[model samples]
Target: MAPARKKVVIEGSVSCVYCVMEGGPGSVIKTDLLPGAVVKLQCNNSRKGSWEEQTKTGGKGDFSFTPVKVSSRGAHKCRVFLVSSPRGVCPLIISDGAVLKPAPPNATSPFQLFTLQPLYFYPAPYTCL
Candidate 1:
């Protein structure tokens, strides 16, 4: 008999920072939540191979993928990437995708929740000055 697949939910958020005279004595940094930003989640499993899913951030910069059913080991191999930004002023510079981390197991829930570090963006070069 085959084992039943497990359900998983992935969640994350995006943010941006505008730095004026960065690294200087009087430098200033402004941070804001990014809404309507697009992000993508990709996962790989030995049995089903690999797949991708995409979603946009909410008004509060939060995003969550629909529940996905996969082998018990599949949820551990997923990554989240920042795709697009709503503000052209805050272009993605030196952005890196984040690996998903599963929260501690819970007895009351049938699905696992995976989280990624908040992705960030910065204003264009020389624009924040």
Candidate 2:
């Protein structure tokens, strides 16, 4: 008598670009959503309280969920409540299976550069497949 375990379903989603840049995924949003557009992937591991999973949006703007797995991992989040691009909630680029830090120096927001030959290392474009 031992057959009941399907709790470890921690799927999440909503990583978007909606279009106007022609980058990678689907790139074309002037207000056209119909590939799987329902838009709602609210998740919560901690940012406030209550928000298990809702799941929608799959037209390249994507959304997914299957939560039930929890052992206090640290942090987890997923949100995509669309309007035009970003309004209510949206956050899921995924990087929590492992390797959470050591890759956070690609920072560039508006402008901030002052290097006279001291520190600004750049060699990891994609070299550790």
Candidate 3:
């Protein structure tokens, strides 16, 4: 018999900086909406195979992927990666689970963003390996 599978949902947002004076560090005086950005999620399947899912940011720079499945006796993880920008000019940048603080009138509000955490499943002691 097969064990029950678990479902997990992964989501996040993307944004870009604005108002640059002298290029170096902290050049961005503020941030604006980066709509239509691509966000990808990668994980391992039960067969030890690689799998990836993608989603696009909306006007609010929000994106979400379908639920991922996990089986017993295996591990699954979905890591978020910045794929591309909306304007095709700016490149993708990996964020440390934190989004850029957007300015007013379309600024992305601060929220509790979650990072990818590895999901592990274990079999029963009485069950065979």
Candidate 4:
């Protein structure tokens, strides 16, 4: 007989801060806002539903997704992907391995909330032709 699997829910937020400084002279700084950016979640187990699900950032660059079912035997892994950027500035997913703690059989939430690492954007140096 096979053992029963547990239900789990995963959620997190995506946000970034853009800053600009003076090329020379003094230090003049400015922060650019990121909103409406598309982010996708990748799940190892397909039974939880579609492996490729997407969501968008809110006005404050916050995003989350629906819950998913995880396997009991193995450590389930899910990766975050960047679909598109509103300002044409794509950021990299720097989050390391995020492991979810198994839920209790009679758990109320049966879920885990992880803190996603910040996405960083590095400007490319320019050279005049």
Candidate 5:
């Protein structure tokens, strides 16, 4: 008989920072939380093959994938990508994704939680007069 694989949880968020260049240099004006943004989680390993999963950001720009059972080797090969932005909200210029790395296991929990750096969207280009 084979042993049951351990379960793990992955989560992260998406946000946008507005930068304005009035005279000398550009500066970030404000940061906004993006909701309803689509995020995709992909995992690939030469031995186990590959798979993908997706979820949308909540009202607070938070997104989480359901607990999944993955081997230790497969967990390190996962990555999170920004799939799409909410229509009429923020448009993405670059869609570079982040690699998923395993964090230290929690002493109280049986499963592991993985978090990625917050994905960002570039604001539409603006012309300065």
Candidate 6:
């Protein structure tokens, strides 16, 4: 029998700012994730600086922070926390923030948010069988 393959996963994203600054809309949430999971957006921008924001998914299998504060810095990461999923997944904080404007509070989606990942989910590759 073929070796049991672990599903390709990305999760419980967290990181520490080595030498960084949060520009405008910093990394706040996971916009795409494995299905049947609860993606949680959490971060520690500074030792004392703190902010709280949240939004849930509806089995849509995609995550993204809405109404984020767009940012640009040397190394500050906008990471994702895979709240309730398998571990050792890819770093949701894949790269630096995009040069796009953040979503307005009156917006309905993350379309305009400055994102590091593709705003759309291609779930066809990962089937949780």
Q: Write candidate 4's Cα lDDT for 28-96 as tens digits.
A: 233344578777766776455546577888887767655444444432566666666676443433444
> For model 2, where is the 10-residue window of minimal lDDT?
114-123
Which of the two, 4 or 5, has more lDDT? 5
C-alpha lDDT values of all predictions: 0.74, 0.30, 0.47, 0.49, 0.69, 0.33
Query: What is the descending lDDT order?
Result: 1, 5, 4, 3, 6, 2
The TM-score, computed over Cα atoms with residue i paired to residue i, of candidate 2 is 0.20
Tens-place lDDT per residue, model 5, 69-112, is 36544677888888888854356535557866667777677667
Residue-pair clashes per prediction, in order, are 0, 1, 0, 0, 0, 15
Task: Please give the lDDT score at residue 24 for candidate 4.
Answer: 20
Cα lDDT of candidate 1 equals 0.74
Q: How does each model score on TM-score?
A: 0.80, 0.20, 0.53, 0.54, 0.76, 0.32
- TM accuracy, model 5: 0.76
Q: Any residue pairs clashing in model 3, and if so which?
A: none
Ranking of all candidate structures by their TM-score, best first = 1, 5, 4, 3, 6, 2
Q: Which candidate model has the greater lDDT, 2 or 4?
A: 4
Q: Which structure is stronger by TM-score: 3 or 5?
A: 5
Q: Which stretch of 10 consecutive residues in model 3 shows the poorest summed lDDT?
A: 118-127
Candidate 4 least-lDDT 10 residues: 120-129
Error of 1 at 30 (Å): 2.5
lDDT of 6 by residue, 41-105 (tens): 44446643545444444444554554244232211334443344332342223233222222233
